[model samples]
Target: MQNTVTIGKQAEQYAYQLLLQQGLQIIEQNWYCRQGEIDLIAQTNDTLIFIEVRYRTRSDYGNGAESVHYHKRRKIISCARYYIHTHPAVEKCMIRFDVFSMSRDSAGEFSSHWIQDAFQT
Candidate 1:
């Protein structure tokens, strides 16, 4: 079995490629702060995006995107605030929270979903 970190990295990578395909330029990956961690930070035009990447091998409970509940949203929001506070360059940019998810089907193939403006601050 793959360790949690390994699985997470793979998920993040899958999300990263999807973002790149959509023309978003990645600013940082796995950005950390005391509040929490932001999986991927990217930019598009004049907007700055904070992304949360979630993956699940099975959809028994819920879809990966559904996993980010209220508390998780709050943590991401707080971390995004901290990121803006520490990075003056992004202070003037429009901020958006996005979620990218991947799930494996019975055939063992993964399908991805991207939710833009997934939540608000």
Candidate 2:
């Protein structure tokens, strides 16, 4: 069985490919700050997006996106703020929070759901 970190890396890689295919310019991956980490950072047009990638092998508790609760959202937001502070060039761009939810079924097929503007600051 794959460990959680391995599964997460796979999921994030899948999400990265999907975003690239959709024409979003990926700026960074696994960006970290004192508050927390942002899974992926991308830009589409004038929008600067902060993405949170969640992966789950089962839905017994909930799907991946559902796992990003209020506290998690707050942490992501805080981290995004720190990111913007450090990267002044993107400060004038419109900011958006996104979620890339991935799940694997019994057959080992992976599925992804991309939620644009998944949360707010």
- Which of the numbered candidates is closest to the native, going by highest lDDT? 2
lDDT of candidate 2 over 16-118, digit per residue (tens):
9999999999999999878989999999999999999999887898988999999999999999889999999999999999999999877887899999988
Clash statistics: count for each candidate = 0, 0
Candidate 2 wrong stretches, greater than 4 Å: none
RMSD of 2: 0.8
Model 1 C-alpha lDDT per residue in residues 32-88, reported as the tens digit of each score: 999999999999999999999999877788988899999999999999999999999
- Candidate 2 structure lDDT: 0.93
Q: Candidate 2, residue 17: CA error in Å?
A: 0.4
Model 1 spans > 4 angstroms off: none
- By TM-score, the best candidate is 2
Q: What lDDT does each candidate get?
A: 0.91, 0.93
RMSD of 1: 1.2
Instruction: Single out the weakest 10-residue window by summed lDDT for candidate 2.
Output: 103-112
lDDT score at residue 120, model 1, on the 0-100 scale: 91
TM per model? Answer: 0.93, 0.97
